[model samples]
Target: MTTLYGYYRSSAVYRVRIALNLKGLAYDQAPVNLVKGEQRSEANLARNPQGLVPVLESDEGTPLSQSMAICEYLDERYPEPPLLPADAEGRARVRALAQLVACEIHPLNNLRVLKYLVRELEVDEDAKLAWYRHWIIEGFDALETLLKRELGTGDFCHGDTPTLADICLVPQVFNAERFECNLSAFPTLRRIVDNCNALEPFQKAAPSEQPDAG
Candidate 1:
């Protein structure tokens, strides 16, 4: 059986869960407690050298790392409900939107970076939260503008159906809310996220619903 090694609250892992759920694929979860530093253990490092949550063990027993790569792999292997658009231009747009969140916003705010800020840089809780909110607002500002003005916008980020963009967007939004980031400025983003959350795929993949959720 396919298995996912990840923490319950990890947004990266959350992304994979949504993709797997959308594909209607059944998988077992192997929780690696990030707070306990279990991701850096020998077992997890063998699966993913980066010490990251969300190492997906394929049915063939091949381990895959990186959330976006794993998501694309699932889309390619199970093409029933495509996560990307059929057209070349549409695919490019969807990837760009997905990257805007995954590459730009998430990197600066992920657990490792936040841990480094507090543990190494001696950042206080207030300052750490300020840093988190600042980047979220900065990234969401650009995302909101693009989604609002882009003619391709539909019920989801790219079109009427959920795509890779929405898959990436929802987890980031979840983290932003957890950090208490003000999202009042991004109504378009909220509207699209609301649509995504209403679906069973997204709902089933929610962090709170995970077996390892604390």
Candidate 2:
């Protein structure tokens, strides 16, 4: 059976869960509690030297890491209900939007990075919150511009159906909401998120519904 090693609220892990659910794949979850430091344990380290989660173990026993890579692998392996666009240009657009969040915005705000800023760099709570909100505002503003101006956007980020962009967008939205980032300015982002959440696959993969969520 396929198995996913992940933390409940991790945006990266959330991406894979959405991908798996969208693909109608059946997989067992093996929760890795990042908050409690289980991700650094030997067993986890053996599976992923980076000490991260959302590791997908193939039924044949190969392990995969990185949320975007995992989602692309899933798309290639199970093409039905594809998470990418059909044309090369369309696919590139989706990937560019996805990476705008996954690469540009997410890394600065991940749990480990925040912990280092506070514990190591001695950033106070106010500064921490400021850092968080700053990134959200900067990223959301640009994303809003792109979504509104682009002809590719339809009912969802790229088209009527969810694609890689939606998968990345939803989790980043979750993070922003959790931090109480003001979202009134991002009407298009909000609209796409609403459309995505209306799907059963997206609803089921939500952080609140995850087995390990507190």
Among these predicted structures, which one has the highest lDDT? 1
Tens digits of per-residue lDDT, candidate 1, 91-125, equal: 99999999999999999998899999999999999
TM-score of each: 0.98, 0.98
CA deviation > 4 Å runs, candidate 1: none
lDDT against true structure, model 2:
0.94
lDDT scores of the candidates, listed in order = 0.95, 0.94
- The backbone clash count of each candidate, in order, is 0, 0
Residue 182 in model 2: lDDT:
95
